[model samples]
Target: MDLTGYPTDFVADLGFPGAARRFLERRARHWPRLFLNGVPLDDTALGGWQLPEEPDTSESSILGFARDAAMEQHWEDEGYALDDTGEGPFALFYSRYGRPLRAGAITGVAGVPEQVAESVESIGLMLSGFFVVSLLTPDDPATDPFSESVLRDLRESFAE
Candidate 1:
């Protein structure tokens, strides 16, 4: 799909429960296949992306248990403190983790290095998620493009 017109700067108010689902559903009308962190997310993925309506009493009750579990574990491994916050799915995930990390995006064409593609895709998703989180949490400002603190951290990390 030609996602050249994808609105990277667009911010959706996904503060309420089920808002993410609705938003995704609406967007699917135009872009049926949405990519999050380089992974394809379609209608089937949406079912898994959402929080279950009921407790995990039976195995069948959980639609995307393994995928969700892996993702949660991945987030935890990446230093995010995934807590039981009563916020929307994306809002909850992005607000706590996305804001602090200040993720950004990049684009590449075919034949791009695997590592570069992965890094750029992940950064793009993080940045977009961060934008959504910022809208949900208006008091918390988004990271400045030319942040001295970030620059200092980079310099210190790279210093030998």
Candidate 2:
């Protein structure tokens, strides 16, 4: 579907641009497949191949409405918020922002997991498939372009 990843600047500002890049690295030394239940992510626009199911949301929020559905309907089965809970949807979102569900360079979150989680939910609710958050969607192919490009940019910026 030609999904658009996050801008390079967004990842860099989070402080783990390199890790995020490596997380998305396509190099042989690096793993590209973001698998879950041993199955490749065929539904992904970025061709995730597969990523292990994270403790957080499973489907990449950047993929589209269906992915977002999976996130809210399935991933947060334990709980994000509740009309009953009354903590507000923001409570769950706070737990997910920028936190890596799966540990790695690219998947590594630049912000706090809770914050990223909350943001993901908020983004999903407000922005839907168009959500453009790196922390909320580190595995999203749309999170950063070519992982390598983002990493190179980060390295250059860091060096300077």
Candidate 3:
């Protein structure tokens, strides 16, 4: 079960020890469908580093993506569909009140998936349904509701 000749401690190198460990443990449990579109984009080398395709702006953008009308319009500028929800960019992420946001295109999926993934895993339980993360650090008590199993499943499914 060695990966692409990569070292075992690859996730740690990316400053994502927790995420790396999570991915390794869960890769075998989730449906492989999540991996179909997602690439084998792990960066175990260089100290568990996975190169990011976009600049890390999760903190600033997450809210904007969720609440800002102007920004949401821009998200649609690229033809990303906007769900009827009053919310901004994330309205399209789900049909329910709070589902984890899902992006179709890789770039549209995220500007920085690693950062977003960590943010989501570390503190996204408070959100109603499972959701993606992008620098949104909710209160641990409020957000830590998601089960480890759920997060692990997503990481494995989305592991590149």
Candidate 4:
């Protein structure tokens, strides 16, 4: 995979090859759900992202639209529920976690629906599950786990 088009800031903050390896390790320990532009990597139409209740601290936040009971209710009311496991279309692109992170949205990457043969596929793997990148917005955000602080925490947690 070619990572030539991924965001420079993300690459700089979290070392690429190391970060990618770490992400794979993290995925092995838990479910695969990476954040990019505040939203998890999903092709579903009604996509939403989560944010921290307290932005000042480094602790993970549980605030999210889809995580809301109402949203779940709405989906249930419509007789639909979000899948709770496994990789979807881009499983091969994803690492051992068996999931694909959404690096397709970032600039320089190929557009969605386009065929990608050997792309390095960049994505923000939100390790905390409830945290998101503090730097970019949904409109112009990097992949999830974009938070350097949270990444440091993840490294420590994994080290233990």
Compare the candidates by lDDT and give the number of the best one. 1
lDDT of 2 by residue, 37-103 (tens): 2233333533443322233332333211112233334334523222222211111011113342221
Looking at candidate 4, what is the lDDT of residue 125?
Answer: 31
lDDT of 3 by residue, 1-160 (tens): 1111101111111223344334433432332212211123233332353323333332211111222344334344532223344211221011112233333323222335677755555332332233223321111212333223333343453544
lDDT of each: 0.32, 0.30, 0.29, 0.29
Q: What TM-score does each of the candidates earn?
A: 0.26, 0.18, 0.21, 0.20
How much does candidate 3 score in TM-score?
0.21
Candidate 1 C-alpha error for residue 3, in Å: 19
Q: Following a full C-alpha superposition, what root-mean-square deviation does model 1 have from the true structure? A: 18.9
Give the winner by lDDT: 2 or 3: 2
The residue ranges of model 4 lying beyond 4 angstroms of the native Cα positions read 1-9, 32-160
Cα deviation at 19, candidate 1, in Å, is 1.0
- Superposing every Cα of model 2 onto the true structure, what RMSD results? 17.6
Q: What's the lDDT for candidate 2?
A: 0.30
Stretches off by above 4 angstroms in model 3 are 1-14, 17-25, 36-53, 58-148, 152-160
Tens digit of per-residue lDDT, candidate 4, span 1-160 = 2211111122222122243344434433343344322344443421332221233334422212222334334333432222232111111111112122333333454423444412424543332122232211111113433233334433443333
What would the per-residue lDDT of candidate 1 be over residues 102-121, giving only the tens digit for each residue? 42654552345787677666
